[model samples]
Target: MNYFFVINARKFKQYLFIALAIIFSAAIVYSEQSNVSVFMNSEPSAIYSVQTEKKVIALTFDISWGDTRAEPILKILKDNDVKDATFFLSSPWSKSHPDIVSHIKSYGFEIGSHGNKFDNYSDLSDEEIRNEISTAHGILTELIGKEPNLIRLPNGDFDKRVLRIADDLGYSVIQWDTDSQDWLNKGVDTLVNRVVSKAHPGDIVLLHASDSSQQTHEALPDIIQQLRAKGYQFVSVSELIKQTQVETTPVEDQAMKQIH
Candidate 1:
């Protein structure tokens, strides 16, 4: 009487298997939805540095406006036999000093765009941002005979909108992991120390080839020497990025990955 209706063992197992399959399928669907949400709401990012274990670094110079500073830096690089560097050249500066730009090209260093103006792209209207990058691209392409696809925004400043606009214009926005702070006109020792102390694998070291960075040329030799001693090999920004894996998370949404 207690088990008037006997249950078949095979039927019970089949039912249990069906229920578990449904739950697993539901979990998968929920997970996919969560991923979609994160992707949709996340902000854009620039390539600040890459992830790699190789002893490689990228030395980048930004020349926004200057005639006096770039040549000395180029000379030091040449004298030191450091050919793997990148210079982000602004349109105005490139126009006024085409000869210096030509020298940079002749030295076999890489060239990237520093945009058309020294103003912050984050503060510009979307249309203005596009114009600045495109105009610089046009000028540099004419001057260098090929379009520079890499850019470092004026002052390394950008927001989500600026990043999106740059990407639309076919630019890979480059930023720095190790800032030399040479623009402060700090002493040669300070500039050298800042860069050498923080240098690491896959680092993009920021040095300036503008008039404001009075001591960068002075410090370049030592920076190169110390980094080389540490077994770091210099490469252009493109080469550095190519050899390493990259992560592109916005500054604000960096914590989004911690959520379930």
Candidate 2:
């Protein structure tokens, strides 16, 4: 009779359930945090910038639409003695201007893929994105004789799927940390200032080499000078990637060994 009066089975069950729920929620939170830390630390393919103390910056030009400024841009880069500036080329532009393609390589510039055409890849499916990248990859490989390990999506538009497909195809998706806003037809001074102010160590600066950006050529010289003045060394995208070397087997190029 005494023992029967003391026990409340239902109450005990409710307390146990609440305790389990608290533990489970805490476990989920911890798991998510751990995943985030890993992703931040180890994602080698899709990199915006490397975390480094050295003042190294990459200047990139997208040359997808027109070739009018191609030689001019190359001349500007040469005049600045800027080596390893990356040029991402669209399939149509690359195919149509074979001489310019040769010029880019001959001038010792790094060539990258700008997709098959100027396509906004934000909404494309994996297969479609793969097709776009693969076609461009094939073309650029043929043109440059080096399978491009890097790609810059058209219009700077990309989704998670775009990055996944790019990785599967042995390409790192490149996005710039410093955009010149030259595409917006901003004036030369404004464009130069945008890059100079936003640039930092391990930054990838975006400028256009196509006729679409009317003032990039004018702005580039100043941008280069100011960046050098600020003590930032200009590097190609490949050289920039070397800072965070996590060795990856990029899909297409067995001949060209790459460190991620």
How does residue 41 of candidate 1 score in lDDT? 54
RMSD for all candidates, in order, please: 5.2, 7.5
Candidate lDDT values, in order = 0.85, 0.80
Cα-based RMSD of candidate 2: 7.5
Clashing pairs in 1: none
Alpha carbon deviation, residue 195, candidate 2 (Å): 0.9
Please, what are the lDDT tens digits per residue for candidate 1 over residues 69-137? 898889888888897999999999999989999999999999999889888777788999999999999
Task: Provide the global lDDT of candidate 2 against the true structure.
Answer: 0.80
TM-score of each: 0.85, 0.79
Q: Which lDDT value does model 1 have at 208?
A: 87
CA lDDT for candidate 1: 0.85
- lDDT measured at residue 138 in model 2 versus the true structure, 0 to 100: 88
